[model samples]
Target: MQELEKKEFERLLPYLYKRKERCPTFVFAVLERFIPGFVFADDLNSPKTIFVGTDSGLYFVGGPISNVAFNKHFLKFCSSKLKEGRRFTLFSGSGGWDGLISDCFRLELKQSSRYSFTFHPEEYGVKEVQLQEPFTVSRLDEATIRSSHEFNLEYYERFWGSAGHFLDKGFGYSVIDGETALAGECTSIFRGKVYAEIDIYVDAEYRGMGVAKKAAQAFIDHCLKNEMIPCWDCNVENLASRKLADRLGFREPSSYSIFVKNQ
Candidate 1:
């Protein structure tokens, strides 16, 4: 198992989930590989694997992209992290979800619009209103996507491989227009586990017509189709984002802040 230190791994976040509009790339961006981003069972030939923490839920990567397996200390760590209100922990083959890991988690929240825990499928009484019309989303190839910005070369280099890496693990994206993109709310996960940490953007010119919401619902539907839970998490202070989540039926499980151990 290879661990990606938080500091070095976070720097590669931006390009991973790029958009011309608002998106949820915060937690998954840099923290994707924070503590135990990648790990494998003792069976070296079992499968190459990785795990990522998202604002909403945990993600897996492996055997080409990444996969989310179990880890030994997962339940113990989940217990510790949860002593507080909100937190995330990844589990590799070290633990089991049903016997032990399940003890540390609830049913990962059902898709509801009860903003206190979720923001989808249901609401006070009615469902959420649409935010925008959906458009096809896609990943900009590294060479092509690289030409779009000039923040860091190393970042783009990692991106060239990440789409394939993440895609193989069930992550996907679509083109908002032709150039811009509306990325994953996660499409597949083998089980009826609808999970998606949707943080996407609508181009400035495309705002006010429900571009973001439209694309997000589309992504959410993708999760539903696969039976994966689609979820969203945002800073309580991010009123706009919070409202958007509520509008889309993503309820807040709780709110908390992350402190940089060194910062």
Candidate 2:
């Protein structure tokens, strides 16, 4: 497999478009150069199979699944990357690709189901949240972003490369107790032409409270005000995330399989 340069990334867009369901937003993030990643294909000029890998995850799109040589090369590449300590969770909408991956890395891969949710405005109406003393909800600013890192805030760095990038092209909301951010909801992946994928995190000390929902509501409202479609995704096993999504107006969940390193 040949690695494609950034300029050649667009060549894979047609393959992405042909798929019936939405590919993960991180796929688009790599193509759009919003973040660092790699793309590989059987042939750059006219390719039938493509792979996109970012810090977030790995994806395979389009193919003649029976291409033994290509499949072998992919396995070797993945093996080498794993040895280098790079973590990857493979995602695809094609059963054929899933089967091929499952067969090749039977011992090393663990299978999991991921659920995607679509936002329904009619189901969600804004509600004011009352925070007890010393807590407040606010938009993420530079100072907030910097301070949040103390709480292990990673969405901005992981998806946007840096705080400057996120502040310029992305947005988020955080629930802070005094100067410490206890919870937040931000765009994990965003494409101006498409949608923003929501990522939420709450500190262990504040899990049961409604802090996450409060932050997510503000984030959702911002997306609506800007006419951006907000998207949600979570592992099928994460019942809490599912419940939160439903309460925030996300519905019609579609399930997909993902393969992650067993470790």
Name the best candidate (by TM-score).
2
- Each model's lDDT: 0.40, 0.76
Q: Count the backbone clashes (under 3 Å) in each candidate.
A: 53, 0
Over 228-251, each residue of candidate 2 has an lDDT whose tens digit, in order, gives 778899999999999999999999
The local lDDT score (0 to 100) that residue 45 gets in candidate 2 is 81
- In candidate 2, stretches whose alpha carbon ends up further than 4 angstroms from where it belongs are 42-48, 55-64, 126-134, 149-158, 179-192
lDDT of 1 by residue, 58-77 (tens): 43221222222345443344
lDDT of 2 at 130: 73
Q: In candidate 1, residue 221 scores what lDDT?
A: 64
Alpha-carbon shift of residue 11 in model 1 (angstroms): 31
TM-score of each: 0.43, 0.83
